[model samples]
Target: MNIKKNEKPQEEQLRKIYTPLWQNIFRGATENQDVDILNILKKVPIFSQLTKKELIKVSYIIYERKYATGEFLFKEGNPGSAVFIIKNGTVSIEKSNKLNIKDVYATLISGDFTGEISLIEDSERNANARCTTNTTVIIIFRHDLFDLIAREPLLGNKILKDLAAMVTKRLKEANEELVKYKLLAEVKNDH
Candidate 1:
């Protein structure tokens, strides 16, 4: 491949890598336009960066499972394998405290998601996810996601970038909360 004198190879490579995913929509992509799964995925932040064409590809690797109320999606010590996106229903993100009391840390409703860590690493789940109501969730297993990446690196890059951003934002929020609580405790001690 001959590089034009005016263009740097690195710049050309980046342009290919960063080609807009939304171009398909402007070009009248009619396929998968009406699919319910595509509509559901469009709202998810992880997949929000994808074009309809890329989303149609994602729809291929997802599994929809319905869980009964009180059923656990995954336990705290279990090896994480999938990211769960709630289609419709309530999910409780629970953690057991040092006193062995079960605490519901977060309640996620329709269109919300969790378990993103599983996609980026072979880590154990830090908390348990239980359905507070009969729930339908879209599960994207790591194996399937990796397979997608192997087939379409661009789509995979977009997803991984989104995952990293989500994790970073959450970690920052957690750190800020910890600082606030520590300050509160120190003030109480001073009094």
Candidate 2:
């Protein structure tokens, strides 16, 4: 992750290209601002309990990334280093396959979190994320999240519990969907 001195300038320039817009969003998250980003985040159930100050703090560690339509954010089975919070536009969650056309797993919108499985275990990603449209996302690096949690155990614990609940809920929903599909298939075959 350490870049040479010569690479630092380029890295900083790249960071600057996207940081301003995200900074504006974070600043708005701190105070009562009428920005669109604030309203979007306000609708997110997971962050509903977060205070403005805490939201701002969470924002500080976030980096903005923009992706063009059809660009793969990360491939399934690649090592994940950061999780993404969709700030704008849509992302497709796809499954890996040997066939030319991969399976479309799910679609993610603004406020949706991805790459969370990396936090629980340092393993290859389970799915691929591709930009379905021109997309802008807020990135939270795993290291930064870990460090923040380490610095504030109480806040960190709360975040972890929230994440756990989210994962659990999603799993249950998927299971229900699977059962419904199976039952429907059985009914059709019974005819």
Q: List the residue pairs that clash in candidate 2.
A: none
In angstroms, how far off is 72's CA in candidate 2?
1.7
Best by TM-score: 1
Error of 1 at 54 (Å): 0.6
lDDT of 2 at 73: 81
Question: Candidate 1 residues 26-55, lDDT tens each?
Answer: 122123322467777877777889999999
RMSD per model, one decimal: 17.2, 15.1
Q: On residues 75-179, what C-alpha lDDT tens digit does candidate 2 reach at each position?
A: 887998887767777787877557556656566766665776777778898878999999887777889988988987766777788778867766675566567
- 107 Cα displacement, candidate 1 (Å): 0.9
